[model samples]
Target: MSWLALFFLGTFTGLLAGIFGLGGGFLLVPLLSALGIPVAEAAGTSLIAVWFSAIAGSSLNWLKDKFDGGKSFQIAFLGIPAAQLGVVVSNLFPDRLLKLIFAVLLLGMIYLMNLRQQLSEQETDIKLAPSPPTPGATGRKFYWWRYASIGAVSGFMSGLFGIGGGLIMVPLQLGFLAETLESAVANSLGAMVAIAASGLIGHAWRSEVLWIPGLCLGAGSIFGAPLGSYILPRLPNGLVTTAFRLLLLILSIYMVRASWASGWV
Candidate 1:
């Protein structure tokens, strides 16, 4: 792809990433593959792009006091190592298989997001209704396992698929941690910085990255990430959730067809 084309692609990807706390890799890898880049190479390139976008978005989150430092660190601690292992495992798969895997993952994510939305709605309704106060059942207990599990799973997917892991992280935070959507998004972006960096190192060591393309994409993301962050807080919670699910639905359909195309493979 031309530098200009890559630049524009990165900008669009970054915009969405900023809004949704994604690393943009979920979209980037498949889109690059569609543009005729090899799947493995696309995945590797996406890590670089994700790294930049995460840094950009995370920085803004921090500046805006939207970050949860302790929680983010807990996720990154396990995520960093898990990401390296993921890269090793990815080398065992052929591009055709990887494409199919990615498609399936997208479909699964759509279901998960939908489930999260429903759960969020239920939680909202429960909060709105009056309830008897419980004396000793404070919901503020910290759970290390929760963060560790989130990190490991998200990190592994990041390495395997070249995504920022926000797809997994945000939903899990909301479901298990009772984080608001905006807070979950901010925390997800924060954790992605280290996770994406670790994945990028592994991909680079394998010589799978296209540096020029990745750099151009990264540069564009730096410009777009802030704009996305700005818009997220202004949007309604339901609208944001709906948009996320819809986007995933569309992408999943496109990925299924692309992965099944024998000629493409």
Candidate 2:
């Protein structure tokens, strides 16, 4: 029954991830908890599942020319090391404290999403012009540092929360790198592949992953990713964004309440 539940959850999560280019850990963590797994265990298992799902989804996108391999690699290089550091830090925190922190982070994320939506609604549309050709040594250094910094932060979040870091990466890319939302989403997934991979390695070394459940979820996600990618491009961006934000808000509230009830607050 637990395996079946994991399979279904993974399918659903993968669909959302493929469509939105998310890490899918948001769905996995709650589903695992509902299945009676310990919170930290659930997080660790979900990270593994998310890594496979990201790979599958990214592959699908790559076939469609939606992925940027160079950008992805640059981000991954920095993010993987940062994720390792995050795992070390996570090990130092108590489980209850971690859960409380996760709850708080989720709430903050919900608020940020709302703020972004409101601000975007009020903003005038500005057309983006073509980026000027990079000039010699100056351009390369600037972009290298920028990409590395983004990767490190994203990686750290992945390690701390066992997430793929799309929730953080997408916004950062859009806001700081001035990338298009679609591009950011795609690129974020690419970066997540590396972050998740590194995190999984750390978790494995720490004996934190549950292989059976993770594999079950990954199996279902493999099928779901292509389906989500197929449906995503046809949907309206505003509608999709609204739906995602609402879902996150509901989940955040639920998680907060759950943490409180568990005396982790």
Candidate 3:
């Protein structure tokens, strides 16, 4: 294996991980496979690297007062258990068809993201025109159950797809919880630590992980994550969120291609 290339991939993915709360699977899984690693091993190793990256990025967010620990913890509380069930579900479906479905869902997410932007725009215009609802007025009661459901759904997707679950979590946080983009990212990263840890345990138990490569990736990711976190605060929220949607769209397109390649689409 080319350790240098792996390290570089880790660095690149780690940067994205920190920026988007994405575990960077859209690159890491393919890169590792290109390097001759089996897909299962690649997923396992990438998950470990993702976990560490999330740890580093979230710690920085927490220190900067950007993380919502309470919400993050609540999300994780349900996510962990659902992940186990999701792993089970992964085995139930044909991989090619499942990936196609996931791709379609990602497209739906892109649409929802745009819809969210429209709603936020309306809110912004309203705020500009007149005395909006009092600042202290409860905007919406915090729906703990909805958050848990988000965790469960995202967790299931994570386990089934062998991913970090951040893609599912981040947009939902924005749409449902009305969190700022930065805060959603910070909270998503914090919550993913638990989800990734659960995935690692399952992968390790199955002996699917490539320990040396995973370690190398994790080492590089920690260094890269802080760089991304540093850049995150400086970027426009709308730009970053648009980039996030584009990234998901690109990944979904990749999945569609993969499905066709596998003769399933």
Candidate 4:
């Protein structure tokens, strides 16, 4: 029954991953911890599901020629090392503290999602009332340092929280790299392939992963990811963004309660 539960959870998370380029760790770690798994083990185990789902989703994007290979590669290369560092840092925190931290991250995500929705609305208005192209708009420079910073921070989050880092990467790409939502999602998934793999290695070294449960979750994600990819371009961005933000809010509340219950507050 536990295996079945994890599989279903993975399927749902995979769907979110496909659409948002998330690794699903944000949802997974908290839920797993709620289900009585240790926070560290939950975080580590979530990475296995993240890795497989990322591969599934990214492959679909690649096949459709929707991927941003160059940016993905840049993020992945730097993210690999940073992920290791995040794992080391994660081991220093206690479980209750980690739950609080994850809850805070979720609140942050809600704020970013609100910002992204506003940006999307602005873009729609611009399209409706076309303006003269701003000078140099098409010639915006690609800054390597910006990409490096995005990769490093996202990678660290992935390792520390068992998230796919898409939660960070997509917003950063939109704000800093001027990528469209779809493009940022694709690139985030591409980068996650490497980031999750690196995180899994570090977690395994510490014997933190729950292999059987993680595998069951990953197997389910394989099916869910393709479905999410198929739905992405067809859905309304505003609706999805609003719905995702709500889901994050609910999860954040749950995590906060869990942390408080841990007698640490």
lDDT per residue (tens digit) for residues 115-175 in model 4: 7666656656656885723325444345666777799998998888888887678877777
Q: Write candidate 3's Cα lDDT for 16-41 as tens digits.
A: 76675456655576566545554455
Candidate 1 versus the native: TM-score?
0.85
In angstroms, give how far residue 56 of model 2 lies from its true place.
1.7
Candidate 1 versus truth, CA RMSD in Å, comes to 3.3
Which runs of model 1 end up more than 4 angstroms from their true locations? 19-21, 126-142, 229-246, 262-265
Measured on C-alpha atoms, candidate 1 has an lDDT of 0.81
Return the number of clashes found in candidate 3.
0
lDDT of 3: 0.71
Q: Quote the positional error of residue 118 for candidate 3 in Å.
A: 4.3
Ranking by TM-score: 4, 1, 2, 3
Per-residue lDDT of model 2, residues 182-201, tens digit only: 67667877888888889888
Candidate 4 CA-lDDT value: 0.82
The residue-by-residue lDDT of candidate 1 on 1-265, one tens digit each, is 7999989989988888778655678888878888887777788899988888777777877888888888888888889999998888889987677877888898888787776677667667766889923224353345666787799999999988898877688778877877677777787778888998898899899998999999999888887777787899999977887788788878877776776784564
Arrange candidates, best lDDT first.
4, 1, 2, 3
Cα RMSD, model 4: 3.0
- What's the TM-score of every candidate structure? 0.85, 0.84, 0.77, 0.87
